[model samples]
Target: MARVKQKGGLIGCGFFAHNHLHAWQEIEGAEIVALCDRDEKRLKEAGEKFGIANLYTDAAKMLASEKLDFVDIATTVATHRPLVELAAKAGVAVICQKPFAETLSDAQAMVDACKTADVPLMVHENFRWQSPIRAVRAVLDAGTLGDIFWGRVSFRSAYDVFSGQPYLATEERFIIQDLGIHILDIARFLFGDVAQLSATTRRVNPAIRGEDVATILLDHETGATSICDCSYATQQPEELFPQTLVEIDGSKGTLRLGANYQMIVHADGQTQTLDVSPKLHAWARRPWHNIQESVFNIERHWTDCLNSGHEPETSGADNLKTMALVFAAYESAAADQKAIDVRRMA
Candidate 1:
């Protein structure tokens, strides 16, 4: 693939950085010229794995030394604001991982910084880009699911997220911030802006500091109601029910995405099933590999936006609504399921 006019760098070479590295290599008109991490060991290891010779322990040093058009921050939630602000200030476009920030104000600040710098900032909220989810969005856009009034986006699994990223277990916000944010963002993406939100959160695992399970009810401006549930304690059979499923009911039809990327649509007096799972890759052999592969689609989108001067799907300003939804869920849970106004939160 030919390189784009603009070359990019990657900050924070952690568990998810490998996905970004692979995706960038696969995309045309994009090249990762440098990689940075706080830990020299991790930085060196990632550079070697990806064949990137330019490595730095300090992001500021990397940004100063490398002439990059963009930077992807794959670091933890705590580091997002500072890294994004730094990149924007350096006149580099940014692709940040979720949750956009630890708080709404910080998220807003990051977005504002990018806007002030006239550089693009996109949140890597990739759930909506999953093949099955994208297919569902296509169906809705085609008016097959006419005027959806009720919907449910659910993710439940016993997978141990704490093993690889234990920091998630100690965070003040749990599933709602870490996992539910993706589901909530998907709802907002497929539906529209939320009007109100009510939620409940519980720390199902005593070992974890924050809530490991959460359920949120949303009222969208389009009069569509959505229920979003995320949990790390769900003990369902992974074979029959693989964590992510969405059920949408419309005035005239219904669409359901079942386990293992199965899409079932009931409309026009007939039923149809669409296999929308992503194509298999060598690195994506595990059961939960799709989640990692979806990041590639998002990275490709980012590169395309940079090349064509278009906005990515998950722009920072657009993702502020998603961040607000996460905060609203936390506020609603604290208020004992009292509905929180989305507009007032802003």
Candidate 2:
């Protein structure tokens, strides 16, 4: 097969856009051709920093005029559907940021639009791509743990996410929607589809309207049970471990992902810690460098999928299950810890 030189167009120039731009530039067989944002200042800044000459304040205008192979939608959750629909209609493949849409209906529409257009759509759910978590997944798949029965994927910290993205604090969905969605998706990725979910939510922080903390119980289709918990209230040394750690207990052994990218596997009376961090790139900056790396990993996967004609690990169709899990968590929490079947929402 000939190597496909895929051109990229980025939508929504925000804090996350710089990371995407840097990653796209570093990846082979991909080039960012243009950037679009409703804010002219942000658009211009990103365009100037990334050396992208073509810029647009309107996505539709950019989609119509630009000759691009794929579009990266880094905008907020509310804007994802329309932009993805536009990109799909324009015959352009799409890589969208997480929480694919505010509602399952909108998410389904986005997926259906891409299918109708015969274009590929991938959700940028990067948690599963994180190196330490990926290593944990590898260990489980290798059967070192053997027939895992229970697990926990937790994220809790006082990171002040509201200061950077204040909209998160005021949203009706709260931390579960913002942070729990990623953790839920990670559980779905590591385990199989969730059969049922029961959850409890709390607004520990007085300032937020939605629950800042949630604990969810997941019944996997494989008879493995898991807990997915998330919070913006808990304080940690670095705030990194609050959510990314994974603990799994299998019939043969146990596995744990600790803070600072440590993966410990214990089986057959033997224990080992895996050195998981790969070399960091020059542009990868602080606070959440691991997260930045994961974003790059997902971007590279997207580029490879476009080049090799394969579906990405985080394909639109696959992400529907993840999104359904998110909604199921909310429904479970709202109903006072009632077990909610995931398929009911579908």
Global CA lDDT of candidate 2, please?
A: 0.87
**Cα lDDT tens digits for candidate 2, 138-181:** 89889999898999999878877787788887888888777888
lDDT, candidate 1, 148-246, per-residue tens: 999999998888888878898888778888889999988998888999999999988899899988999999999999999988888874543234789
Task: Report how far off residue 129 is in candidate 2 (Å).
Answer: 0.6
- Per-candidate alpha-carbon RMSD to the true structure: 1.5, 1.5
Off by over 4 Å in 2: 1-4, 241-243
Each model's lDDT: 0.88, 0.87
The local lDDT score (0 to 100) that residue 143 gets in candidate 2 is: 90
TM-score of candidate 1 against the unseen true structure: 0.97
Candidate 2 clash pair list? 154-243, 155-242, 155-243, 156-242
Query: What is residue 330's positional error in candidate 2, in angstroms?
Result: 1.1
